[model samples]
Target chain A: MLDTLDLKLLEEVADLHGLPQGAYNIRKNGQAADRKTTANIDIITKKDKPGIDIVVKPGTKEESVHIPVILSQSIGDLVYNTFEIGAYADVLIVAGCGIHNPSSEKAQHDGIHEFFVRKGARMKYIEKHYGEGEGTGQRILNPKTIIEVEEDGIVEIEMIQIKGVDHTVRDTEVRLQKNARLIVSERLLTNLEQTAISNITVELLGDESTAQIISRSVAQDNSHQDFHLNMYGYSKCRGHIQCDSIIMDQAHVTSSPMISALNTDAQLIHEAAIGKIASEQLIKLMSMGLTEDEAEAAILKGFLK
Target chain B: MLDTLDLKLLEEVADLHGLPQGAYNIRKNGQAADRKTTANIDIITKKDKPGIDIVVKPGTKEESVHIPVILSQSIGDLVYNTFEIGAYADVLIVAGCGIHNPSSEKAQHDGIHEFFVRKGARMKYIEKHYGEGEGTGQRILNPKTIIEVEEDGIVEIEMIQIKGVDHTVRDTEVRLQKNARLIVSERLLTNLEQTAISNITVELLGDESTAQIISRSVAQDNSHQDFHLNMYGYSKCRGHIQCDSIIMDQAHVTSSPMISALNTDAQLIHEAAIGKIASEQLIKLMSMGLTEDEAEAAILKGFLK
Candidate 1:
């Protein structure tokens, strides 16, 4: 059952203003609380574990699927979800997890998700990690996303973790086949001694394949973050990886991005930036009547947006 | 004779409102236009070349010196300049060059400047490069800056090149001794098929030495830019280098930064980012009643600022 706090969290993470339409699965307190299956999509619970297998037919189109998890008590939860998208199918998959810990104990969530996008299919995946509590309990989330794109498949991913996660380690690996394309955009924020680590590796293994990975993050009040991204371009492909972080109030950030190209026609580039807020930005906002703090917050909001 | 165009170029490069008061030298069209020396600062013209040796007294303070070069006609100019700051002296030096070529011939300026900041002294150096004309001839500038800081010395450098120049090559090298500190900030802009290349190297050779190099650049309209920076911490020291660039309208930017730390206590970091303007920034400005073009210009201006 979803309470007021649970509803607010669902809204915060997945924009589930009400119950999601089409096919959906809601997991709460380490168990599935609700589920639905549409005509074109099938959700099968894993017999051996605490997860599900989502399957879409070859001609499925314009369908929205939501699989969100929420925890309101101090506990440790793990799940393995697999997605099989058939050829020529187009769908949006929304999977976000939120945890609340009000006790002295810790609340953690670990999820491993694997997606297989079939030939000529287009998939858009959005995942958000969120934490909320009243007491001093630490909230943690670790997510691993593994994806394989078949020939001519297209995928766009958005991963966001912007508040109240005391610690997290996000791992992602992706492989692209011939003529496939991928775009992954990620954002994160940490403050008050929180720590976040991200490791991502993408390989363009077929000709004419391309991938772009972009990340933006901010650390404040002694928080620390590390970003490691590796991109490989082979067989007349192209890839790019970029990382940008803003460090404030003694916070530290480390960014290391590597790019390798095997074929002579393959092109790859990597870029990273770590710095504090620009004083001119503050001045410009102040001239428009906002205080320094307000200006900095506005700038950071725009940065993450 | 300093014509109106020459005076405008002077103001654009060095902020020269009138004849400089304390110590000044103005070079116009491959010849010296004016020269002046104050009580504590001596400008010695080199007998064998078209350059000068600047010597500052041991205790000179709160004074400014200006050296400006203006090329109104198509010509090639080369000069070698040196600075000798006595022990415990603190001063500011401004050196800027502007070229105007309204003919069918190439115009170029090559300058090599070397500085020695003695023990316990401090120096502030600023240089700007600009070009303007209405001709097909090329406007090119090549500058080299070399500096050495003795024990307990401090040096701050500001180098800016914005607009007009068709081609440029900038080279800089610095060495720091025990307890010395160095900070160098550079900014550049290229447009309309222009090209710019910058190479810089720094060595922290003694205990407690620290150095920081920051560069911001923009390339637009088929322009090209390449930035290469290297920092070496050979002892118990710290060093940081950052390069940020905005690429627009088919432009290309390449940033390569390397940081090496040899000692166990040495701390070094390097960051670089090359991207287009953020859409959020544009929307933010557009929300404030500006058009898209106006918003983009504002963002670029703030970025360079």
Candidate 2:
């Protein structure tokens, strides 16, 4: 029982082009719908748990799944989703959340997502959050993500929130075991007095574990943002963090990156930069018959990409 | 008459390998000494001024001068020096100050230097400051530099302070005329609870003026450093500021760069990064049979250079 707006939002956030025949998919709006089960994946919910459990069978071939949550108005309860991958499985998950509030009341979504990757499993997860409305309603989101990687497991996550949301606070935590790897990329843009804060923590708990975190953000027209990335290295591990931001029109941004090592063999490094667009970049684009504003927008798009 | 210590200090600061017979030179301890005059240069002291006046004749060929100051012990008076360059002149000035105190008392040096560059003139100025002693005495330096560049003028300044300074506060200001350009490069190293603060301001007052400021610093063993660079663009000008710092062993560093454009055609940008030495650099160096400490020191030296 989906409407036109729901279909459009699902397409926007989750890239749901057509109905699936064999692949697993989950559509949730306060309750689950169109839940599928296949030979390689099993999606089930328990009576005592609040969210569903996804089990990818061991030694499964490369596969994909989509889970999109949408809300067209204010909701009364929170949303919780969990995913568990088995050993030697290779899978990709495309998931996101979108809220549309076209009224005078405030609408919010607090999403909690947890993922567990077993030995030698590899996973790629992408999530995008957005809001759009012309009314005076406030669209807000507070998302918390927890990830655990077993021995020799690999996980890569990409999160993007580009426009329309009034406020957001994203919290992410990840732990890596022996020979495990984690990579996270975040892109955000805030304008018109909107605010955002991102707190990310990564722990390299075993030998030869590696992690990298990269963030790109833009603050325009009195918007504000703060980013904190903390990485801890226990054994002979490696970690790196990087933050880049562009500030315009009295907007403010602060980035603090901290790396602490408990052993001499651990190597960690970080770098941060905050400034406006470079003149040479703009001039080079304008030389190709683009206006200044168009050149700036193109450069921003490339940067986020 | 100059003593042996004075001669050694001059050699260390100004690189005075041999005495020049015709070049203009001004050596000051508490007062000016070894003042010389040439055909294209005249050194004169004014009655109402606390410093000397250096006049370079217009359309002169390339020339070189050395103005080095030394303070072997504590001094109660402030040192002031000024230079005035005529139109279409080209010159290079090597200037520095050194303080040596081997007692329990604190030693201080406050030097003020001003330069007036005429239209179409070009200049390259280099200054090196240092302090050395074995006692519990503190070495403090407060230096102020002011520069005015006329139309089509060019000025480049390089300042270095490597070691042995306990405390220092450096202030520099510059004003640029039409089509003028200014460039400044600073290198510093602090260790063992030392502290340093650098404040710089640049004003582009005419059309097509350009400026660049770059600073590289190192803090080790509980040292502290702060850098502030402010650039104001009032016309169709361009400016960029960059700061990079390395911190180790509980040291702290902060960098703040501000660019204010008052015109539509003006473009400005800034970047700052603070962190420890990169592991790749250290590993690359150590792979060449160097020790870890040696590799770190070599990296620091290369960064300062």
Candidate 3:
């Protein structure tokens, strides 16, 4: 029972053209709009809390879950979701949130997600934050993610925030065990008077564990952005952190990538860069019969691609 | 006249196979070993210092000068050199230093270079630093460069320090006027127990002034490095600063790139990144019939290229 606006928001945030095939949950305007569960996956709503717990069977394969949220009215919604992947199982989780407020009241959403991957398990998580409306109301979204990987487990997370959110602060923390691996990539953009702050921390605490964090962002007009990342190696592990940004017009960007190695065999490194578009690149594009503005737009599109 | 070792040192540092044409001066073992000059360029010994002053006439073109320093013995040497480029002229300047210490005594050299580019003039400066020898003594080099560009002037500088310097520090400063441009590119590598520190600063104080600073460095084994760069835009100007570093083994690297904009129309950005070699890149190279060590070497070479 979703209208055209709800369908469009789902497509924009989670790449959902219609109702998902596998287990899924859809919440709109602070209430559950649709839900479905499969035999291998169970999405049980918490009796004591305002959220759901997803449990996947052992050795489950080719199974996925979609927990997408949308808002068409101004409201304050806060939810907590937990995920547990069984041993040797592999799964995909798509949890995206979008807000379309057309009222004068402010619209805000806070989602806190916690995940646990069992021994030898693997998971791919994708979460997107988006906002759109022509109202005077302010759209705000705050997302928190915590993950723990057991021995020989692997986890990959992709977090993206493209446009329209007035304010956001993304917080993430991860811990890896023996022979575990973790990779997190975040891409974001901020324009107008919007501001975004991201804090990510990862710890490799077991032998041969590895983690990598990569972030790319752009700030345009009068926007502002800050990225703070930290990686710690406490055993015979390896870790790397990288952050890059582009600043345009009167925008401002600040990046800090910190690494600490406590063990003798631990190897860690970090790098960050923030600058505007290269003039030579713009000129090269303009030479191909494109206007200055068009060339600039094309370059920015490519940079964020 | 110079000996075989002196010629080899020249070739290693300044790319001079023999006596350089046009204008040139060679210093070896704390004394002048060769000298030459052309009609438009004059190399005159300083009366108050142990150095030389190079002067280029107005509208001069296709003219170049070489001032290469070589130290084959363990000795302490210090020199100060200055250059004056006339208005509407364009020229190239090569100043490189190499030290080969084979004695038990420590070898050190400190060079301070100052340049004044007149109105409408342009200059290209190339400098390379290198050290070698199987000696118990340490090799140390400290170079300082200060430049001031007048209206419509341009200055380009390339500084390189490859290997074998046990300890070194480089310092550079620049100031640009209206329509003036300054570009500085630096490349360095440190290994073993060696340590290197670099400090570079630039100020854009006029309308339409521009400055760009690019740095690439690699630290291997137990080596350490520190790179500090600063750029300030005081008027309606543009400036950019970028630093990239690769860390290997038990080595450590720290980079700080800071920028400040004081005017409403001023635009400035700074970026710094530090990391190890990508495993995928190494695997790709190894698939082409290369060993792991060879692939690592090839990647490092390409990175610094």
RMSD of each: 12.6, 7.4, 8.0
Model 1 earns a TM-score of 0.57
CAPRI accuracy category, model 3: incorrect
Off by over 4 Å in 2: A1-3, A16-95, A104-125, A136-155, A166-182, A188-304, B17-69, B74-95, B108-123, B142-153, B167-179, B190-305
Candidate 2, residue A176: lDDT: 94
Clashing pairs in 2: none
Candidate 3 residues B166-278, lDDT tens each? 89999999999999999999999999999999989888888999999889888898898878787766677888777777778887776655565545456766656566777
For model 2, residues B1-305, the per-residue Cα lDDT tens digits are: 66777777777777775554445555544676677778988878757756667788887667877777777776644667788888999998788877777777777878798999999999899988888877688888788999999999999999888888889999999999999999999998999989999889999899999999898888888787877777877777878777777777766665655555555455666656566788899999999999999999999999999
lDDT of 3 at B67: 94
Give residue A119's error in model 3 in angstroms: 4.2
Question: What's the C-alpha lDDT at position A146 in model 3?
Answer: 94
Query: Each candidate's lDDT (Cα)?
Result: 0.86, 0.80, 0.87
Tens digit per residue, CA lDDT, model 1, B1-305: 78899889989899887777689989998899989999999999889987889999887887878999999989999999999988889999999999999987989999999999999889999999999999888999999999999999999999999999999999999999999999999999999999998989998898999998889888888788878787766676778887777777767666656554444345666766555676788898999999999998888788777
> Which CAPRI level is candidate 1?
incorrect
A1-305: candidate 3 lDDT, tens digit per residue: 89999999999889999998799999898888999998899989988878899998879898899999999899999998999999899999999999998988889999999998999999999999899999989999999999999999999999999998999999999999999999998999999999998999898889999998888888888887877787777777888777777777777666655565545456776656566677899889899989999998898787767
Candidate DockQ scores, in order: 0.04, 0.05, 0.08
- How high is each candidate's interface RMSD, in Å? 8.9, 6.9, 5.0
